[model samples]
Target: MMSKSTPLAALAFALSATTALAGDPVTYQLDWLPGGDKAPIYVCVDQGFCADAGLDVTIASGRGSSDAISRLAAGSSDIGMADIGALMAAKAQEGVGVTSVLSVFNKGPHAFYTVKDSGFDSVADVKGKKIATSPFTSSNVYLPLVLQDVGLTEADLELTKADAGALGPMLMTGQVDGIVAWMTDLSRYTGQGKDAGKEIIALPWSAAGLELYSAALNANDAFLAERPEVAARFVAAFKKSIEFCQTNPEEAAQSVVNMVPELEHGDVLGSLNDMLGLVFNDVTEEDGLGVFEPGRLAATWTRVAAAQGLDESAHGAEDFVTRSFQPGGEG
Candidate 1:
């Protein structure tokens, strides 16, 4: 009485039903090589938020911001973590699925460091002086525009390619007069051969009429459409993790050190504390953590487009964001 196709169809239905019951697996690629700098993500993973959300979230390290963006564009990553600069660049080229869901740094931390005795009172004073920088970062190019506003050009100084570590010595030892770095970076370098009376002039990027957020959450399109619920849960847990970090910084730092062990650049607690101060200050307490307002962040996208020559890039907050996964409305 039972037809062959009917039995086969029933079996297929049962198998499909079973698969649906299984949790969706996803991997999140970090914007940079994992370290204390990525403490919040570790906190999220260790706290079991990913598991609670029915997502087997596997967080892995990326070569750099660009590398992370590339992987996110390819759908190789379900949720990709990266800076707004890199994400905007990716959106320009491929019309990718990456959309911002969280803002890691509410304030930009970038500033140039100079010894107080150097007689540099402001960001504009380093004309004809030696400067150090890590190339390809938003700072490398944006600094030039910033300098132009103060009547200084790249030609006014000898620019050397360098990282945060090399920049300080280049200053203390007099290799470079000043370096484009961050305030938090200066704090880290204070004990490592930092001169006692060497007061620093902090050149905040925000003062130049430009406010930029450093890190953010970007997810692949396939994931957004097929698994919106999973995305929302992860964001929810990520917000809680941030809150936990803000309230319990010392514990958060220790937790991060436990999760990642390859960090050799500096003390785990120091970096974790410093990074937390930069991204997760108590300002997130009111509306909740990792909150990104579309209107507030649209300016950042515009800045990214202008810097990367994205003349043809679709430049709308809508193209790259869906707040349905965040708090308030579940974007």
Candidate 2:
């Protein structure tokens, strides 16, 4: 006769069986490297949110919004984050097989970083100053529109493109009066400025009338069509993760550090705190979280069309979004 199993062996077998029947496997793609700005996905996995929603999620690193969108369009990832503006541009140009499901950042992340002593307190003050930016940033495309709103143009300022890593240093050393970067990096840049004995100020283009959506959760068409239930569950869980992050920011930051050990805890926490404003702010308060109001969506497409020189009438903004997968959506 077989001997009775020990308590430990019995518990192990039960846990294994539970995991085996836990959930369907889903792949998540990131628009950029692992950081506090990308904390929600990490929180979902590390905090059992995905598992609770019957999803076994695997995260894939992405180089940028374009890269992430491409991966989703190719069916390599079920859902992930990307810039909604980039999605609009790609859909207008190529008609990619992906659609944004949830708006993560309701407002644009584009901003100008300057040292306080540089006398550049707002976008209007940079007309005659020297500016440095990363050549690859999408912000460069909208710079002219923002400048136009401020009654200036690119010709009014001296612009230089440099590596993203060098932007903070260049500004602190007075090599450039300001640098263009995302609001997500405000904490890191401010810390660097403190190290250099300078005070950093961020001039958000949104305040200067550059209004539009930024990052959002997007899904592959095939994934949504084949397993609509799974998509709905993931979106619901993802929404819960964002709410959790807002209530427990330190824990959310720790979730990223838990998944990516190379990141420092304090740095992750600081960046996560800075990013919360982008996720939950006046826009969120007005329109509710994750809902893409029709007026704002159209405005986003309008800005994108102008920036990329695409025909505004060629495609409607709704073409790039599939709202049925939202938490209380039709799906």
Candidate 3:
């Protein structure tokens, strides 16, 4: 029967259906396997920040920064968290469709690790010494620039390319004098040292005047262009999640563990604490979270372009990033 309440019920149903379809769905790709480094993304999901922002975000684990960027460029992911420097290098090449939306790490984590008793006083000590590194590591892509920064050349060191899993064991067994790795991996080698009764020493390139930006939040061009508002909402939620992680790292680490149940609880917490220090610093303190300094970004682009032999015109840092999506206005 044609009743008035029937029409009202149908109208309400239609509205609910429309609302349900309105939330944007996005795949948030991580640069590597779930760990402390990825706590903020987990926090955003666990705390309902992404849902509150009208986003249906699905988190995906990644192989590495290069692999993450490749997937994003191939249009498999809407957004990605990865090594911004590696992304810059990829954007320099043809057929990539990704851009930076926010900066996650203000400083690069690239460093060389050696045992304290190994007698490496500084980066110079790496000269004429065998240094192990995985070919897939982002440290390999920037090794030339790092060596240059220390006034040394590749010829100065005996380099060995090995699997990441083999690096710590090889170093511990004295197969290599030192290993090139990200600073966050210190906890790993530290644990190994504890098992072997040795002390690990880190020589971060930033301390040696080769400062570069590391992991960043990125979005593919099509999604960023087709749905600007969705991107902004995601950014706001991410910023809130980052703040939560900074304030309550232990809880945030627990959330990450809940997502990646295979991860060790203490290891995840340690890595989360180390990553947080890189996430918040003098620049973030002044500009707010997820903000990047234009000057620093520009300088970083110059160095990266030179290192990768990319055309400056094609790899303009300005085009690779947009500030309108940050928490406040431009950072």
Per TM-score, the best of the predicted structures is 2
Best candidate per lDDT, number? 2
Residue range with the least summed lDDT across 10 consecutive positions in model 2: 322-331
The C-alpha TM-scores of every prediction are 0.83, 0.94, 0.91
Whole-model lDDT, candidate 3? 0.84
Query: How well is each residue in 263-294 modelled by candidate 3, as lDDT tens digits?
Result: 98899888887788678887678767777677
Candidates 1 and 2, the one with greater lDDT: 2
lDDT of each: 0.70, 0.92, 0.84
Candidate 3 lDDT for residue 279 = 81
**Model 1 over residues 94-213: C-alpha lDDT tens digits?**
766678777777666667777766776677677878888876555775676667667777888888997655777777777778788765564566554445445556567656655666
Q: Which ten residues in a row are the worst by lDDT in model 3? A: 322-331
Deviation in Å, model 3, residue 177 alpha carbon: 1.4
Candidate 2 whole-model C-alpha lDDT, 0 to 1: 0.92
Off by over 4 Å in 3: 1-22
Better of 1 and 2 by TM-score: 2
Q: How would you encode candidate 2's per-residue C-alpha lDDT over 1-331 as one tens digit per residue?
A: 6457777798999998887777899999999999999999999999999998989999999999999999998989889999998888888899899999999999999999998867898899998999999999989999998999999999999999999999999998999999999999999999999999999999999999999989999999999899988988899999999999999999999999999999999899888888889889999999889988889999999999999999999898888888796646552
